[model samples]
Target: MKARSFRFFAPFAFALSFSFLSAAPARAAGPDPDPWFGKDKALHFSVSAAIAAGGYGVGSAIFDARGHALLLGAGLGVLAGAGKEALDATGYGDPSWKDFTWDLIGVAAGLAVAWTVDLLVRGTGDTHPLFTAPAPGEMKSLGPSGLRVVF
Candidate 1:
């Protein structure tokens, strides 16, 4: 009886978790088509990808539902990306869709990395990635070379 319950619960948990994670990135305001297409785009892409990845990791750790975590993370990442874009558009920085796209990509990458790592770790034991807000300095690359600050 115990084993039967476990079996049913496990699949339900997995399905629920996956549904949430997969839907996260798509829930954000549709990507702005105008700004995500041009110059200095690589920077934007990298940032977004990192945000996604970071958010997934943190989200998974805090929430019982894996999907919820992914959703929250992706949502936060999109907000960050949009904020950056809006700032640039207002002449605060360079408005580059390239950058926003990169941010999204970062979020995705973060999610993938976190998920893969979590799966591998779970098989060995019940460990998850550490979660903490990234330092301000950790946010962007420095100089024309786009070198990240390592600490």
Candidate 2:
């Protein structure tokens, strides 16, 4: 039963991720033009880490297996990143392997961090960061200026 459900949920989750990637807005070049956009790399990192940690935690809990959870979390991260890149390649946004790679790294790092923290805490608590919704009127910049705005 668990195996069957795992298979079902995995694909469903991937599909949902793909849908989200397809729906993400294209990258714009500028100060985001949005007043609410926070031009902070820390925020992006935090968001990525939080999502990854959550993925790891949920995977761990559902599978009751660390290896399986790690694999699933990494696979999901890579798939989601690649899917997003593909969507961006459609001229709707910027398709960047760099971004995908970094995202994957972030996901892996987050998962590792969560696992380590969990172990250190002796499984008594979780250290997964809470996910936060982006604010409206957010804009992201693209390119070398290290400008990527999000709301």
Candidate 3:
């Protein structure tokens, strides 16, 4: 009973303490409450970008359509950004839309890069493997000395 009561009241007590602390007089000189290009925002952007790129790779392997893969990557990035903001909203950290915006930008950039690389790998044509097959009857073998051809 005692432990349960403590657990229940602890959060309230903690919240009340913050309220008291915040009640202190403000100073004239201070940093912005939330800057658009802060370190935290940069972290959010980079992490979202990585998530998007990874999602794109996985999606590309799973889906034959490039558009579908792009959608999956974008969806994953948005979900990650929103999830983080949701966590912040739950009193864990400062929640700001600016961070979400940066995350979105990062997602776009990551997707663009992945798409470009995919295109480059596929060549000018649609869905071509990186290595093209040699002409018939030209045997190619892999040995200790690397690729060897027997004409």
Candidate 4:
């Protein structure tokens, strides 16, 4: 096509294409448009994990029992997630079960990591260091005395 004809055709074609796009039905906004794996979900997960791990460390320091520490960590994590949801329910933001689910998963992951670190640092035996030899009297309990393994 000639330069002049090409210029005229180009504008007409562009306008025609846009007209078709505009004719399509518009999407209605209701629930969140964010995907499950979006940045928002990542933030939620990371924040909950940090909270839970911090709580676990603090709880471990305050209480001798691992169970108490576990409860503290899980409670803090759950409280954080639930609090956010409750705030969203109050019209502060969009409430999402997906975000809460991610938060729960993060909490679990954080607790697992913290628990592993504790075990490594504190050791399951009388000695604090994981690689060290067990105390003399403690060696007697090493065998299959009331121990069970499941696959």
Candidate 5:
């Protein structure tokens, strides 16, 4: 009986002691916080740009379409940003729409770069793999092309 009684009162005593521990008083209302330049925003942009470029490159290689690559990369980038914000909302950190906006902008810029490179690779009218002509003075025969495998 004594053991059982102690167990019940022991929890109550612990809870009562915890109730006595007080937190610091809240601060008086102040001016709105100023927006500052954040390094984290820069990192968010750069990392998103790199990831978007890679995603576009790989998607372009697999799909063989610039528009498809843009869609795939942008969609993924936005989804990733949204997911990150959602994770932040879980109380680990403060979430911001501005960060996601920067991500979207970076993704668009990176996808544009990927598209331009793809165009350069594909060339205007040539279907050949060779990006450039042999020389201005010499006429060269097209060499055998190798098979490309994409996954």
Candidate 6:
């Protein structure tokens, strides 16, 4: 090929190559489009974590063992993460290993949290808010029902 002919196709070749290369990583990283800090990773993490927590709750309700619940939670987390990745690979979204990595992290965190709560509530299993109002009989009229404080 002559120099002039090659020169004519140089821009087109460059554009095509650039187009293909650009899609290597930035597939569907949400609005930011940054593969590293994309919202997709966050979504993956949350969804997997929720599924793990749900599994723990269900297993705990049905099984008599805490460890069994934890194990089932971990298994459900793994399955949910893999299912999410497989769904993404169907062209509905960009499939990313990084996203799945975050999902695993979320699963571990969720498991740890559920385990802690289970242990904490083992004896009483009573959950209550910090503040409690007195009954009508015990209610005091010593001061205003509501007070406004100025900063």
Per-residue lDDT value at 135 in model 2: 44
Tell me the TM-score of model 4. 0.62
> All models: lDDT?
0.67, 0.61, 0.79, 0.79, 0.68, 0.72
lDDT of 3 by residue, 55-128 (tens): 88886665445666688899999999999999999999988999999999999988988878877765433333
Best by TM-score: 3
| Alpha-carbon runs more than 4 Å astray in model 2 | 1-46, 122-151
Runs of candidate 3 exceeding 4 Å displacement = 1-29, 124-151
Q: Write the per-residue lDDT of candidate 2 for residues 55-126, one digit (tens) a residue.
A: 777765544335555666667666666776788898877665556656666677888897786556645322
- For every candidate in turn, the CA RMSD to the true structure comes to 20.6, 24.5, 15.0, 10.2, 13.6, 18.0
lDDT of 4 at 86: 93
By summed lDDT, the worst window of 10 consecutive residues in model 2 runs over 124-133
TM-scores for all candidates? 0.50, 0.48, 0.63, 0.62, 0.58, 0.57
Q: lDDT by residue for model 6 over 1-151, one digit each (tens)?
A: 6999999999999999999988787556466454766777788788888888889877665444565677889899989898878998998777888988988988988888876786677633222211222222432222355532211
Model 1 per-residue lDDT tens digits across residues 7-120: 989999999999998887654588655564554566666667677777877766554345555787788779988998898899997676557667777778767776677667
Local error of candidate 5 at residue 8 (angstroms):
85
Q: Give the TM-score of candidate 6.
A: 0.57
lDDT of candidate 4 at residue 65, scale 0 to 100:
51
Reference-based TM-score, model 1: 0.50
Cα TM-score of candidate 5: 0.58
Of 1 and 3, the candidate ahead on TM-score is 3
lDDT-wise, the better of 3 and 5 is 3
